[model samples]
Target: MVMGGKSALQQSAERHLWMNFSQLGYYARGKKLPVMVRGEGCYVWDEHGKRYLDGLSSLFCVNIGHGRADVAQAGADQGKQLEYFPTWSAAHPPAIRLAERIASLAPGDLNRVFFTSGGSESVDSAIKLARQYHRVTGNALKTKIIARDIAYHGTTMGALALTGIDSIKEPFAPLLPGGIHVPNTSVYRLPPDRTADSLAEAVKRRIEIEGPDTVAAVILEPVQTAGGCYMPPPGYFARVREICDEHNVLMISDEVICAWGRLGEWFGCERFGYIPDIITTAKGLTSAYAPMGAVIARDAVAEPFLNGDTSFLHGFTFAGHPMSAAIALANIDVFEREDLLDHVRHNQDGFRAMLESLRDIPIVGDVRGTGYFHAVELVRDQDTKEPFSPEDQVSLLGYLSDELQERGLIFRADDRGGPVVQLAPPLIAGPAQFNEMEELLRPVLHKASELFPHAR
Candidate 1:
């Protein structure tokens, strides 16, 4: 059965749909919802049949790209076999097999997998596991979590508490206690004397100030995704690992947007050369074809509970749905068959260079990030590194966001870390896609330069 026409879809959306993290009033203010109808490879077509490069990989989840009939069929076949089942006190073949596969791919002894519905749940589950792991191991006071400033973990109470973004957490004040924030690894913004070591040192200092005995774990994205794709400084994660180890605190790697082929590695921590005790993952797990997330814990973290009668005490009904597991299995197969990891590894340099070339744009302040994930920070003056004024931020981001989409490029124009444009194209995107991205971005960025003519 075909979906309704454009007007019906738009009306239905405006009348009923409540988009997450969206300004609904903006939609009411003379803007029709851009309804995407179909997707294939690195592009998605809007209701009007206008195709745009899937630059942000549909919120950085479509790792293998869209239109994978094989992946869909795998889930469909699983549905036919067993549509749904609760993981509580029960086991299913798809979940069992997928868990084994994920354990195989996960780094170190992170063998135990606790499935969740999505990234936020995975994070929340990890946070609970961290606290409970310490408590089970007799460090009940170790319930605090340390995260970097401006980092985005998730939106659930526990996860949101761990999130370091002030604006997001402001409205929902008095969150779960014990969530501490430290300086993120935005080396571009640091003083000339502050090296990457400073960022790591901040973590160590926070742990010390918080009293390491009271801190359960430190959760960080290998490359901070929501904080402008900020890649950690050299030796940052290694030192962070050392600090966590020294303090007897677990290190939780939140790879919601960094896992799979996004970082040219199975896990982002691997890309940075550290083994976190708990790894939270989602997004690319099933390439956004199905919703699934997992908290992969090291042996020590899971051992206490497994050895005793203590249960995790937290789970979702659809945590390890058979269909999601089956699709995830097929997703991994597609990754291996297509060599998505190697594809990203090989193409990232070109991808990065294409973005780096945009440094010529006057408004483009700093371009940072690794692998397929990247962001272009905007500023009024490149020399001074002066950020756009509050007025300019609103106007520039609005203009760029609208212009880029109008020009057939669909990515994120985020002000979460100043005015920035982030791109995380599908892993399958190559030179041709890179060219298209630059083709659309260059003119829009050029226009952005014209907006702040005084700076030019």
Candidate 2:
């Protein structure tokens, strides 16, 4: 059970496991990594039996919380009935029924579902769907997609093109072309002349400059996650919808992290009061109990393919896998039975209040977001709104990244959006969970602020 003075699990992870978005060199340097072995409710336990609050919902996906026996049982039962099947030119009961259920829950005419294995694939599929929809409708030149700066769409090549973060995309150069970037709704940093609608107007201007006929779709998250939960301003999406309609471009709501009650609604677009032509979703679709995603298209978008002898040339082997479909159905059952959406709606204000109270700490620059997803932006000078220098960011975020974990809290301390602490606890979380988060966050952030005297 031991190898080189480390447990087999640790050794194996260091030698063989390649974690996503993680620096493997950290583990290779013989640092002890926290190996999570069990999860229940709003907490997860490491191999050493240390319990940490699942504040980020294990990456903003575990909406129903962890270790749901019913959800797991559904997959197991489905496996016994039909272990695996492809939805390509064939249908299974779980996929058929789940699609119908999702359609019923989705807004507008987003009834047709094209399945994928996960979020990245969902985004990739959506990108292709938009282009194909345009091509099929006889607009072959409509190929470009416009996305927001600092938005994390996905990691696949197509999705990567849509991702506006330069750090992650540089090495994967020569990505799919025609991916344009626009300013995001980080209203906290907007200049005085810029109004709330200015963010939405950026999309309009980009579409015009790109030649409206050449832009296939506009992809954006309801509340952008990479740049630390940048929420949309009032009437942003509605204006975007109008712009897209005026230009005959598709609006794609990339709801991989925002859907499935993460925003206190079935879909993030619903929360924002606008319906997109296509919705690319995953994550809470099955509450992360199973890897599944779907690109839901409005009736008009799916119409061309549904015509006689015409078909959408796209699919995945595991798309609508029977077991995942069953798990999704079961997950939805739990959502309805527990009324988790209503739970979030009832509790979101208190959660926001708890995070807002942290503004008393000098390092806390801004507290923003909705429902269960929120972020506390770190700053060096709150009065002047001065950002932390690169070195200061390393010192502040590094201390927080390690200190919060040592304090048995699993929240995100990231500089992806310039020094931020993101929190997206499971939707089942309530006041007690919020209190626990505050207790852990208040001190760690206080200690972090001490790293910069100006912040203190």
**Number of the top candidate by lDDT?**
2
User: What lDDT tens digits, residue by residue, belong to model 2 across residues 33-68?
Assistant: 889999999999988789999999998899999999
| Residue 64 displacement (Å), model 2 | 0.6
The C-alpha TM-scores of every prediction are 0.97, 0.98
RMSD of 1: 2.0
- The C-alpha local distance difference test score for the whole of candidate 2 amounts to 0.92
Candidate 1: lDDT over CA atoms? Answer: 0.91
Give the whole-model CA lDDT for all candidates, comma-separated. 0.91, 0.92
lDDT of 1 by residue, 1-456 (tens): 123434777878878999999999887786768989999999999877889899999999999999999999999999998999999999999999999999999989999999999999999998898888889889999999998888888899999998888989999989999999988888778877777778898888998998989999999998887758887877888898999999999999999999998999999988989999999999999999999999999998888887768988898999999999999999999999989999999999999999999999888889998899999999988998988888889899899989988888988988877788999999999999999999999999998798764376
What residue pairs clash in candidate 2, if any at all? Answer: none
Counting clashing residue pairs in each candidate, in order, gives 0, 0
Off by over 4 Å in 2: 1-5
